[model samples]
Target: MTNKLKAFIFPLALTLVSPVTLGETLRPEGLLSLRELPIEEGSADIQRLQITDRSGMVLVDTDKALPLIENEYSPNSYDGYTAKLLAERQTKITAIDLQGERYDLLSPSTRSGDYLLLITREEGNGAYNFNLRFRYDATAKSFDLNQVLLNENNSECDHSLLSTYSIDRKILGVISIANFDGRRVFGVLKELRLAHQTSGNMAEKLMPETVASNFDAALKAYKVGDAQALKTLVGYFLSGDEDGDCEPGNYIVEKYYFPQKVGWSNDLGFLFEQAGHYPEAVELLQHITRKHPDRVVAYLNLADAYWALGEREQARQAYGQYHEKMTAAQKQARIPPRVLERK
Candidate 1:
C-alpha cells in the first residue's frame, strides 16, 4: 500500500460519526450496576474473578468462595428487567444442543462503565465445549442478547474455563477465548466503541487489505532480510503524528478495528529487536506478555530487547520470570542446546 493509503487506514482515535450514513449511533443512558448472582449449579469452581475499567483501574476484586450447583439445569427466577434479560440468556443456552454436561457461572455479573461482560461455561461432551458472553448494556440496564460472544472449541485437547483479559483504553482484549488456534491463543481484540456499522452492531472488523497490505509489506521486507526497510515501514505504523495520535489522517469507516494477532505482534517485535530498535521492540513485546502471558517466548524476547537497550535490571527481571515459569522439559524443548549449556 502507498504511504498515503496506509496513513488513511490506522487512525489514533476513531470518529464516532461515520461519513457513510449507516445504522443509528448507540448512546449509553444510565449508570451500570453490578451484582454477584449466586451460582446454583454444577462443579465448575471459581478460578479467578476481577473487574477493571479501560485504564486498568481495578473496580472490584473478589476471591471469595463461589456457590456452585449440580449438572441439571435449574433456571434462575427473577422479575426485574435486567434480571429477566439474564434469565432469558440462561434459558436459551439450556435449550441449545451444545453437548453440554454442565454450566458454570464464571463470575457474578460485573459492569465496567457502559459494558457488562457476563461469562457462562458449558462443559463439553468430550471435545465440544464453549463459554458464552452475555454482553449487557449498562445504559439501557439490559442485556444485549444479540451481542453475545461465544468462545467455543471442539478440539480434542482439554481446555480451561478461565481466560485472561485486558482493556487498553476503549478496547477489550480477551485472550485464548475467541482467538485460540488449538495450541497458541491468538486473541480476539474488540474495541468497545458504541457505534453501528453496515456489517452489524457491535461487530469487530478484521484488519482489512488496506491495513494488511502494510503488514504484508513489512513481511516482504523481512523475508528478504532487509532489516532497514522492515524497520522503516514498522516505524511508520508505530509513529505518531504531531498530536501524538497513532492513527493520523485516516477516515475510520469501521466502527471497530481489531489489532493484529499476538503471533503477528511477536514477529514484528523480534524483528524490531534484530534491527536494534530496542524501545519499539520493548513496547510491542510488553503488550504480548500482558495479553498472552502463556507465551513464554515473548518474555524471553522482551528480556533480550531490554538487555539490548542496556536496561539490565529490567532484563534480569524478565529473564527471572521466564526461568521461573519454564519446566525442565519445557526449557529443554524451547531453549536451544547451545543456550542450555550455559544454564
Candidate 2:
C-alpha cells in the first residue's frame, strides 16, 4: 500500500463517532428515537444504517421520489412542531413528506460529535400526536430513532407504520441518501457543517474541520463526475499516509478525541475509484482483501486500477487470481466488449 492510501483510510476509519446532540437547538445534530408507537422498515438503504438498536432518520421526498433536496429553498409552508424536549406519537405520517415533512434530521451519526436537527410535521388534519422515539446504543455508540403513530394497530408491539431500526445498542445518526451523485455533495456539505460545529472553535488551530470536508467533497466531486475534487481527495488520502496504508487515521482519531470504526472504507474506496484515484483505489481494495479474501469485487476493481496505470503485469496477475474464483457465467456476465480492447 502507498502512504497516500494509508492516509486516506486512517483518519476516516478512526474518526468513529462521539455522542451527538440532536434537535435544531443543539446546532449540528445527532441520534433519533421515536417512542409513541413504531415506524415501519420501508427500504434497505434506510434499513442498512438502522441496526437492531439505533438508526438515523431521513425524509424521503415523496413528491420528487427523492431524498430531501439540499438546496437553499425555504422549508415547506406546512405548519408543524419543532421540539427539543419531546415529540408526540398520536399523529399520522402523510404520504407526502414522511420523515422531514413529518420530521427533519441530520444524516451521519457521530460526525465528530456535532449537533443535529429534527423537524416533525403532521399533514392535513393534524389530529393524532407523534412520538419520535430515539434510543441510544452504547456498543456501536449510535442511536435507534424513528417515527411513531399512537392510535393505530392492536395491543401488538409497534406493528403499525412506525419507524423502527434493527440496530443493536448503537446510537444512530439520522441520515438520508439523496440521489447518489447529488446526495454525496450535499452530504459533504453537511459533513463540513458538522465538523465546524464539533471543532469547538478550533477551526483555525487544528484546522479541525477542513480534513473531513475535504475528504467528503472529493467523493462528491467524483459523484457528479468532478475530477479535481476526486483527485484532491485522493492526494489528500495519500498525503495523510506516511506509511502507504489505509488506517482511518485512528492514531489521529485517538489523539484528537474521536471514536473509530472500519465503517465506510469500501464506500470510501468506491469514491476514490470513481474519482480515478486508481492506485489509491487499488490500495484500498487491497486493504479489504486482507479481511474478506472472497470478495471478488475488490480484486476485480484493483486489477482494473492497475491496468489503468499501465501496470499490465500486476493487473493481469490480479485479474487471473480473481478470475480463478469466479464462475464462467459470472465472468461472462461481467465482461464488456471494451475489456477485450485492452492494450
Candidate 3:
C-alpha cells in the first residue's frame, strides 16, 4: 500500500445514451417505486408509493428497504435491480400506495436527481418496515449501481443510512463498524467507477496494509494537536477514493466512517465529542435520535454528551438505554453508578 500518491483516475460519467448493452436486460418502461418502511396497518395515513415510467411501469417490492428485481431478461450474469437504501437523517416516508408499497418518489418526468433512501415503520407498533425512496438526483447524474449495504446486520433494528453523490462511502466505514463488532449503515456503490467487490461473508480478508499506514501517520499528527494534519486526514475521509479492501486505506476508511453506528449522525458526532466540541456533539447526536429512532446508541451517547454539559433529564434518558445494553456481569465490572445515572 504505497501512499506515495497513487496516481488515481476517476471514470467518465454515464450518458443517457450509454449503451444498455447487456442484450437480455429488461427494458424499464415505467417508473419503479419502493418505500423505506410500511406505515402502521390501520393508521389513517397508510404509507405507500406508485412507480411508473414515462413508457409504463417497473416492479415493486412492498416490505423491503432494498428490493432485488430478478431479471429473467438478462443472461449469463447476476442481473437484477434493487431500490436499495441505508438509514439516514431527516427521513420521511412521504407516501404509500394501496398495495402496501412505500415510495420515495418523484414526478414521472423528472430525469436525473439524487434520492434519499429511507424506511418507514407503522406508527403504532413500529412493526412492518418499508423502503423510502426519494429522488435527489442532479442534472446528468444517474442512479448508483451499488445501493446502500450493511456488512452484517448486527441486529440493530435501526441502522445508519448514509448517501453521498460519491461511490466510496461504505468502504471507509469498514473499520468503524468492525471495531464494535457491530453493523453500520451505508448506501451501496452502484457507480461502476468505484468497483467495490463483496462476498457473502466479508468479515475477514481485510483491507490492504497501506491504508492503515497512512492512518497511523495521520493519527500521530492528530495526537500532537496538529490541525493541519487533522485537516489532511479529514480530507482523506471526505474524498471519493477510499477503499475498505486494504490497510492504511482501511484505517482511513474506518476513521472517516467512525462513530460507526446507524442511529443518527454519530459519525460526525463522535468526532465532535472527541474534540470536546460538546455543543456540536449534542446537536448532532440529538439529530440522530430525533430523526432516526432506530439508532439506539445515538440516544445513549446523546445522554453522555448532555450529562457532560450538565443537562439532566436528557442525560437520564440516554443512560437508561445504555444500562439495558449492558449485562449483569458487565455491570459488576464497575465504574461509579452515577457515571451513567441520568439525574
> Would you list the C-alpha lDDT of every candidate in the order shown?
0.40, 0.37, 0.36
Top of the candidates by lDDT: 1
lDDT by residue for model 1 (170-260), tens: 1332331222121111122121211221223333223323345666787899889898898787665443435453331121111112243
The local distance difference test score of model 3 is 0.36
Model 3: lDDT of residue 15: 18
Residues 115-178 of candidate 3: C-alpha lDDT, one tens digit per residue: 4333322122221222323432323223222222222111122221121112233453422111
The lDDT, on a scale of 0 to 1, for candidate 1 is 0.40
Model 2, span 137-164: residue lDDT tens? 3344443444322211111221212221
* 2 versus 3: better TM-score goes to: 2
On the 0 to 100 scale, the lDDT of residue 265 in model 3 is 39
Pairing residues by index, what is the TM-score of model 3? 0.27
Error of 1 at 93 (Å): 31
* TM-score to true structure, per model: 0.36, 0.33, 0.27
